[model samples]
Target: MTPRRAPAERQRDPERTKAKILEAAKAEFGAKGYAAARVSDIADRAGVNKQLISYYFGGKEGLYNELTASGYRNNSAITDPATPLAEVLRQFVFVGPSDRDAARLFVWENLEDSDVGFDAQREFMQRQVEYMRARQAAGDFPDDLDPGFLLLALISTASAPFAFARVARAATGLDPTSPEFTEAYAEQMTRLVKQLAK
Candidate 1:
């Protein structure tokens, strides 16, 4: 007879399973928008049974929510209120290629406008508004400028490259992931902000 496994060993580890689902979901969703992405694709990427994806995450919507929610947590850390805006912007722009998938997922969600996608997009926008208000109150931004517009401008400068790769390539002649490009872009934005504030 086969030996019985301990209960701890036998029981499914939900955290590990959930993480696997999220990782797969990020890749699949990044490559294919929410409307086009398939649960079987995520399950295949994770090397898990399709039923496991449903069992752990409830469905594609749940998987997408988990990934986007986690992205917010990760991004919020880097943009913490205590961090200098310039430093935060620098890190935000130059944080390397690993974040490309997250960035892609963000762009895809914004383009699709599904319920789960919109929630993530709304949270990001709200955070940007709060950040802009804080910067304005601290005199880091122009007093005469609208905080909302300034925030939108800053976000555009930082994120446009990720969303519009062709434009970024044509104007900068540098890949979005290049260190030189990131540093140059960050410096340019910093100078612009300072000039505007003055």
Candidate 2:
């Protein structure tokens, strides 16, 4: 009798496969930045064929765009009006890997002076500025302060530890990415933000 052919690999789960590709892509983009990350490497990391990336994301640019959008989507709660501003600041400090990857991606964009996704970033920040303006009008803070600048300051303060890890560690003698540092810093940031609103 003829030898039986090997069974075909089980069918892939679309959502799970996409998630695996995204997670692997995030790591690759974060470590090497968009300019240097490769589709084949991400595929290898995800244990999927490289063509799956193109099939799912349409290619590297699409993967980068989706990664950027997902970062915002994952942390969209931080901007919810129902959340107190101080709590929002705290949440920003305690955000997970997606935000960290976004921060790294931002650094790479800055280093390369690329404007790949500035419009989307600008639109997001504009909404944030509008929210801050509304908060100022509601007497959450002094109306004399520019809402745009205030929002910028708050974001920078929340993101400083991640974006400036070396300086953060040097200044505080604590690893900026550590739970100890994040917890303490989140509380301090919340207090400071509350003071601003008062």
Candidate 3:
């Protein structure tokens, strides 16, 4: 007799399966919010068994925490201290992974009052503030501007285009998720930042 297979669903590579589950979870959570999203739905979307999700992530809460870490706000590799802040801002807005769906997930996470590790992002923002301060001290950026406000402006401007993509598309008859729209938006934002320089 031939050896029994472990079942077709269990044949996937572990990393790929984990990634698919996360992607599916993000979509479900984004659309339905955490309160209503179902693990079975995520499994259906991912083409995996629901048991795989629970096995890999310890269920929804653990999966959500992983997502919080994956979002743009928690990304530690995107920043380079040696790179100019303006360039960093541009990359973050345009070239970085377009995590617009994750922005929607953030909305759900916030409304549910889940401990999604907002502090991790705050720590990253604080680093940006320090970077801006250094630039201001060097007479490159505006010295009169508050670093906190500058950091806020940078992140908010970068995130808003994606966060409000549907609204923007509806309001302007343009697809905010499209590269053309995002590139133009980032250019405008970069120009606005440059205008603030001393």
Clashes of each: 0, 0, 0
Give the root-mean-square deviation of each candidate in angstroms. Answer: 2.6, 3.0, 3.6
lDDT of 3 by residue, 1-198 (tens): 977776885576999999999899888988878879898999999999999988999987788777666774555556655666677788878643366567667666656765555665567667777777777776557767787887777776777665666777887677877888877877887787777773
Per-residue lDDT value at 44 in model 2: 98
Model 3 weakest 10-residue run by lDDT? 94-103
* Pairs of colliding residues, candidate 1: none
Candidate achieving the largest lDDT: 2
Candidate 3 collision pairs: none
Q: For residue 104, what is the lDDT in candidate 3?
A: 68
For every model shown, what is its TM-score relative to the native structure? 0.86, 0.86, 0.77
Candidate 2 local lDDT, residue 120: 60
Clashing pairs in 2: none
Please write out the lDDT profile of model 2 over residues 130-177, one tens digit for every residue. Answer: 777766766667878898888878878877886788999999999987
Segments of candidate 3 deviating more than 4 angstroms: 1-12, 72-74, 95-97, 107-113, 166-173
Q: Candidate 3: lDDT of 125?
A: 65
lDDT of candidate 1 over 46-98, digit per residue (tens): 87899987787788888888788878777776766665566666676664354
Which whole-number lDDT from 0 to 100 does residue 89 have in model 2?
76
Candidate 2 local distance difference test against the native: 0.78
